[model samples]
Target: MITRFEELDWQDTPIGELTLRRRTEPAVGQEIYEVRLGDEYLMSSLFTVAEEELSTLGLAAATGDDLSVLVGGLGLGYTAVTALHDDRVTSLTVVDRLGAVIGWHQRLLLPVSAELVEDPRTSLVEDDFFALVRAAPAEGEGDYSAILLDVDHSPRHQLDPTHADLYTVDGLRSLDRHLATGGVFALWSDDPPDEDFLETMRAVFDGVVAHVIDFANAVTGGTSSNTVYVARSRTAGEPASDRPSKAGS
Candidate 1:
């Protein structure tokens, strides 16, 4: 018997075919977890520096000492696990549109899944992140201290094209309304900084910064990078309700 790898789960979704696979990496001599959407690789346990950074840096940006965080993607649980690493994070809600992905974690098919689900502070919500963020109540205790997004590829590209609107000025403003005062919003993008996306964020939020995280790509044996966009909520503004929806959102 070849003790190399196995296919654990596969499913069909609205956008495309989804797969969960685990394999032994001969080079690294350890098991690796992977998730794929159609023909594209979505995430791998081998490389998660950027994902962890998104949570760490994002939570650090939140002004609140005790944080309530919302993570837009579940992936291999790297991002959410990272968020919990910070003791300041009192609560974390992870939202995903796919139920199969959640099942994997709940079943403990992945290594990190056990920690995430077992934690009392973690809650998993199955929903469309884009619609949820946009439709959230404009203000109230429903707001989160920080929102870390790892759902799509980037603002310019996406796993689901519909995610495009969430990066728009209007969509961002709507999301802002769901943030607690002095909240922080961070996104993990596999691409570099986008000037247009930066401009849109600046108009809707108080401050914005794009961080480039570099990592070695084992497959290509070359350096590769990802970007994390972190922005803050406007603190000293007139009530957000009075603000006009930016044109061309």
Candidate 2:
């Protein structure tokens, strides 16, 4: 049996209907928070291993002091909060296209929401992550120390159709322009590693690593897995187009 603590917040978005609900699991006596996009579940507090790792591994490969990070999605506040846990992260900008998702955190509708808002280093940005990343960088300026992106399901399958291009060589070049020297860019994928996507990352960044994350699913009573792709930027003069193309390689 389950008990709902508050009325569900539902909103119609350009993409679909977004809903936030709070509940208590009587079986375990645990408070649970969930976010759903239409009929599909976006995130749940119960499954956070991969979301947390998106930050852990993103910063682990980053080489810098007082690192500034940009998290692409604010789902359940797991990735943003995890990044703040690291002492090296001086600041984090959590960006999402959906204002409702950001508002849920602002209104404390979710359990992890408070932790993200209370942290001085954390700033909630309500904007499309792709648009922000693709914008041209200011002259003689670097944007972020690390970028942890979980906006889509995977490189091949995107929550939005426009995201598919971002996984390609031309699209990755746009993101590479904003990274600081040796900065890391990590992506979380629901499916296993894709060779084409890995090649695209390799062509754009210097160091590329694909991590397959495995965790047990209590609801399904079976093992589940996700993939994390991490890559580091190169110094000046190494433009993405200059490198060998993933298609040719």
Candidate 3:
């Protein structure tokens, strides 16, 4: 039998004080894993439906086999692991700003950590996903077929104020340079669909859709929903060759 709760690991990161913990859920009578940054709850194993759907809905929009995927956030590993479930995905690069989060998976501290770390298609890269999207990849590296982002709370609320720019039209254009032609860009947001952000995405992408994923809420005993914004990289009358070919290593 496990104790009611246990702190698995703790680290002082440049962002904040990060902590991983495991606890027994009395309602479900099962162990739950959670990660917290400072006073905010970053992820909970109990509520991963939306996270998994972020990968599912994103990849569904992508076209082509042997897809290369770049995941902007590595939380409980559900998003990355779910992306690998698709046989079409040949390579997956998961980037997180904090190295401590990557260490949790490398150490197999979380239940799904081993699955992500052991998968040959997966590469755990420690870097700022936001920064990488705006920069060029290494010489041999290529653009990704899909970029799934789950970092900020929403287009309006960010974990860090510096992330505000990524929600803007200019910032999105910089990110657009990192995707292959017809590639997909998907984002997970805690809030409902924002019309303003939707307009912002449309300025760069050919088509954009916001998918609301509803799931059972164990804590609330009701249904909760999260929005996944899926955008295709090709714009109207834009030649495929005109788009920039760049990605982060």
TM-score of 2: 0.90
Name the runs in model 3 displaced over 4 angstroms.
Answer: 1-3, 235-249
Candidate 2 overall Cα lDDT vs. reference? 0.84
Give the top-scoring candidate (TM-score). 3
lDDT of 1 by residue, 43-117 (tens): 999899999999988988887568899999898999999999999899999999999999999999998999999
TM-score of every candidate relative to the true structure? 0.91, 0.90, 0.92
Cα lDDT tens digits, model 3, 1-249, are 544989999999888999999999876779999889999998899999989999998999999987999999998899999999999999999999889889999999999999999999999999988888667666767478999999999999998888899999898888888888888999999999888898788778866878888899887889898898998898446743433222110
* Candidate 1 wrongly placed segments (more than 4 Å): 1-3, 138-141, 238-249
Better of 2 and 3 by TM-score: 3
lDDT of 2 at 103: 91
Residue-level error in angstroms, candidate 3, position 110: 0.8
Of the two candidates 2 and 3, the one with more favorable lDDT, higher being better, is: 3
Steric clash count of candidate 3:
1
Error of 2 at 48 (Å): 0.5
Ten residues in a row with the worst lDDT in model 1? 240-249
Instruction: Report lDDT per candidate.
Output: 0.86, 0.84, 0.87
Candidate 2, superposed: residue stretches over 4 Å from native:
2-7, 25-29, 139-142, 238-249
RMSD of each: 4.6, 3.7, 5.2
